[model samples]
Target: MVNIIAVDDSALNGSSTGRIHFLLADFEFTGADALHNSRMTFFFSEEQSNSCNKRGVNPMEPACPRVMISGRVKKLDTTSPEYEDNMEAFNNRHKHFKIWVQAHHFYLNELEIENIFIVAYQGGPRTIDAEDYYNAQL
Candidate 1:
């Protein structure tokens, strides 16, 4: 799985070396609305960054070994019957999955989210409004 995804230090550009730990944290899905387009709030301090830092990433830079990834699912814009059906199916699973991210030198920025899904699980929780996600101020 690691081979399929890219792990680099460019994602932690703004972050500096901080306390690092290895731990597991639960991330929930926010339906459509998000604060500053944040998928999830990563408590990196709770997780150990050593194991995932095989790239010898700078400790002074920000990096996370494991973090849950999420994003806003776009709604169907087409009117075709087939597309409508597909959209229905998509909505069923819209925000009910958990994607575990193993980032080496990545941040939550747009360019670095492509590899946040080394591992994923379906049927976790339904979508929630953005107002409910305010607590996760990532």
Candidate 2:
């Protein structure tokens, strides 16, 4: 039998904020170490809320999540013959079944995140109250 699994926020916590959520869909695992050389894609979802947006609860447009290539790795002794300084070989030293999220934030069991790019959102602040109309009326 093929058992499929879905990684959702239910496995994480609702109180967490300021971090993107990633879901590891499908694929059944008998053990945490069973995943090896498996390529997976994670999607990031943004939330619009009074605390998140702080712009009068208006929904915000969703941004596309970036994809990163990573896989399981096995620990190696630096003195081993398989060890190399090459980029490709250097990345293949670790082994485990774990989903990565953005850096600087602790990821819960339900949340899996991967960092791709650093984006700076630059713009004037927004307000929900009517300003132009109030000024004109006065």
Candidate 3:
């Protein structure tokens, strides 16, 4: 389970995109090791409905944007089709995470979100770049 500790949306004042950084805890560990807390930041942009018009898509509606997740990702067996499925599922989870945050955070809920991007760091923000916490996507 994850718990949101804080959020900062001050970037919205200058751009169409902004970021929300939150702390996550209460991890359910399954292996022999355990983790402390994680700090995740979500970067998102508003929907651009006009972009579809240039592509000649019907109705000129905006296409479904994809969420890009970077850092601490699990290694997949590229030879199997399951890799693709796993990626798709991961993307969906990111979407849900974004929605959940927006629902709970008033400032985020007020934005016209379209694309959600996530970057995670395993340790505290100050030590995120340490050797012990190499970035990956999971």
Candidate 4:
């Protein structure tokens, strides 16, 4: 099964109420930028793994399906004074996000397998601006 985790910031799509799938893949970050926000972080836990497995997606396919993860910050602005005061907390969160991404890579690596492809691009290149999403979180 495809092991996946999703984190979203907007709770739901721009139109939907509660939580929806649209916000889950709205932006993408690369290089050192993904570590920018501590509050905007996501990690894969046992529960997350089980959830993805339940979806019955294959992880070893030549074009493995992509899983988008996004998360929200308590506040939208990352440079607010409050965020500055909690820089330590922010760093911790960022580190956790990083760990999840790394863990996924490591797990796939240990399998010594190929074909479980992960597209590292972001911003929904395949879709319109309004439908775009970040791919770095997954």
Candidate 5:
């Protein structure tokens, strides 16, 4: 499945159309000069690498499918009850996330706690984004 995550999408795209763009700037943090930050940082969890090992696959080795987070919000689509329930489960971690993001070392300031959503794929670590949410509390 192709997953898309739009960052401060308004910067890349003129409007809040919620479209995904995969350019270096869209994912990189150059410095403080750029006021535009998607903040939708992407990464393959340690578990992902372990699973790829079982399949005789090098997670980031050559020939592997591009590892990416690209997709629009699923809010518009009526997902199965199972999916809906799982997504709602994020509320449980809201407190912890809010705490960690505030801690000095690791910072993802662009995220709005109430607006986060998890995108699961390949039966592994789920991608996350706070943009393009439905009925967001933010």
Candidate 6:
């Protein structure tokens, strides 16, 4: 199981590299010694266009935003070729199960996280009362 210890969304604008923005989440995995206290950074962008848009649909509207994951976790070696392959596979899975936002809540598959702060460049950041979305089963 995975327990989210903390989430940092303050750097939504500050953590940008060119057009992409990222959110960092801290997690602790139980029932395993190797994956205790791991950190994952989820990369996303407001400017990203949806590639799966139909002919009449506007591609500018963010439909199923693409998210990428990269981090320093104990279970994987960041510098290894296998790590790149694994991350690619993980990201490919998300293409079908995309990260979506609703009412300031971020959902990935069955996990619904309400503490994430979402900000768009056109407006201010919308936030919710901080609450832990923990004990999520893998």
Q: Name the 10 consecutive residues with the lowest summed lDDT in model 5.
A: 17-26
Between candidates 4 and 6, which one is better according to lDDT?
A: 6
Score candidate 4 by TM-score against the native: 0.22
Q: Please provide, for model 2 over 1-138, each residue's C-alpha lDDT reduced to its tens digit, 9 standing for 90 to 100.
A: 122323322112233232222223223242232345333333222331234355333233323212231222222233644223221121232212132222322222211222333222334222222233223331
lDDT of 3 by residue, 18-101 (tens): 323222222323111113322232322222344435556433122423233223212234466644443334334354555543
Candidate 5 Cα deviation (angstroms), residue 18? 12
Q: Which pairs of residues clash in candidate 3, taking residues 3 or more apart in a chain or in different chains? A: 71-136, 71-137, 72-136, 72-137, 72-138, 73-136, 73-137, 73-138
Model 4 segments more than 4 A misplaced: 1-48, 60-82, 85-125, 128-138
TM-score of each: 0.21, 0.21, 0.21, 0.22, 0.27, 0.24
Error of 6 at 94 (Å): 6.5
Q: Clashes per prediction?
A: 10, 6, 8, 12, 4, 0
The reply for model 5, stretches above 4 Å from the true place, is: 1-34, 37-49, 61-66, 70-95, 101-138
Mind giving the per-residue lDDT tens digits that candidate 1 earns over 1-138? Answer: 011222112112333222111112123222222323533332222125464356565433434233433343223235645443332333233322113323321112221122223221233323444344433444
Give candidate 6's TM-score.
0.24
Candidate 4 lDDT:
0.29
Tell me model 2's lDDT, rounded to 2 decimals.
Answer: 0.27
Best candidate, TM-score: 5
lDDT per residue for candidate 6 within 1-138, as digits (tens), equals 343322222222333112111122223122132236344434454334443353343433444233433333333345766444433343343443225322333212111233445443334544433242233222
lDDT of 5 by residue, 1-138 (tens): 123322332322233423222222213343221235333434333344476567676655432333344222222122545333322233232334434323423222222223322323355543345353533452
Candidate order, lDDT descending: 6, 5, 3, 1, 4, 2
Query: lDDT for each of the candidates?
Result: 0.29, 0.27, 0.31, 0.29, 0.33, 0.33
